[model samples]
Target: MTIATTGEADALPEILTERRGAVQWVIFNRPKARNAITPWMEDRLIEICREVDADPAVKALVLTGAAGDKPAFMAGADLSCLQSVKTPEDYTILEDRAETAAMALEAVRVPTIAALAGACVGEGALLAACCDVRIATPSVRFGFPIARTVGNCLSIKNLARLAAILGTARTKEMIFSARLLTADDLAGAGALRGVVPDDDLTERTQELAEELAGLAPLTLWTTREALRRWRDHGLPADGDADLLRLCYLSADYQEGIAAFLEKRRPVWVGQ
Candidate 1:
């Protein structure tokens, strides 16, 4: 459907963008590929998150996959993109970008929600874990096939974040065996708020988002900040803080901010 305000469809084929009251709704646009995160899609995702962060009108955010009349959030990072990173350094750069995007989602001032419907696998699972709330559909499944498929290590930061959010035992089972968690199992394990039928998932998610939007803005923002800081505060003596500082100060950050305020799509010059 066309978005009357923007003169565009509410959702794009790659990523649907819309505003529902005080909530910024970003739906993954590629259901054909199970909503995999392509490199370009990753860039667009970060830009959208940055825009939401700067918008005072947005009180909450929702991330889900674009599945018509169904629930399927995202599959994971695009396997196609991984083919280019042959060397260790190349892989590290790719991970850095993904990590930056994940951190950006956490840094948003408003509460974020992720609706997991079908295949929330690999990097997609990690992204969902970072959100403040997660809702799943009956057919939803979660797993990271990285150990078996990618042969890449999950960063210590991601490991800690997942373990803290999902707890030690569940986290170990998730990462070690790379087993997929069914929606019912996740709900029982406290990973998701509840499991809805696929058809009702969007309605339920919107209901929760709207509920959050009605709250005192500062109250929610500060609460989110506190939770994030509490978890990120003890990050070990890695140069992550310094690196992240540099990223915020970089020319890309400035371009991103300017483009967002101008309400035009950013032309990211990956500096």
Candidate 2:
């Protein structure tokens, strides 16, 4: 269902939300762009998380991309948007919003599930990791491909989130190799709760959401909160800022952006 949100009236909303029984479904709606996130979408997502948290009636939250022949839970952040962020100040602002959005999703009071398909890379992968459970189709391609496509780095918080699910070794290997992890890869790592056929994704997700919705809410919330605190116990207030600057401020980053837009290989040189 189309949600009436504050945005340009002429343009389609990048994010759409629907209520299915006690479950709230949040769909990333920009199918033409493979649902790559823009700053505005991130803001909307944060708002949705807040709304869900405030509503006691909402028992579960499910996030997914719009249906299409080539679906993407989210390809990543929009490159066109990232291209505009050239300075450290701009990058900081961008990361701040993204981190806020991710944290918001992680802190949702209801059980969260990611109904993933196709590309779920970079920021998309990180956000999916924030979900309490993930169910994907065979078409799922998950990982951080920044090393090959963007030449940018993830913040320490994002790394920790991934590491928590995929383990530190696989996480490091994922970034270093720049290879997209398939459904089997994620399922084997215990990151994906289940992998179903592409056609059954929606039905399966709804069934799982309904089951979770029937459980004791306080128990679910407590378990989620406990794990979150355990994962975040030692995280510093300032996390990998220098590393973010090193990559976002580098010449190779600019080259990567240009090459990606131009459909060419990025010639990366450590700056």
lDDT of each: 0.74, 0.89
lDDT of 1 by residue, 1-271 (tens): 2212221223355777889888888877776577788877778879988898788898889988876333456777775565555444665678788988898888887889997888888778888988989988888888775433433456668877787667878878877886888887687778787788876877898899888888887898788788777877877856454554444444555554455346666665555
> Candidate 1 local accuracy as lDDT?
0.74
Off by over 4 Å in 2: 1-11
- The backbone clash count of each candidate, in order, is 1, 0
What digit string (tens of lDDT, one per residue) describes model 2 on residues 9-105?
2166788888999999998887777789999999999999999988988999999988655868999999888898799789989999999999999
Query: Which TM-score value belongs to model 2?
Result: 0.95
Error of 2 at 221 (Å): 1.0
Residue 85 in model 1: lDDT:
55
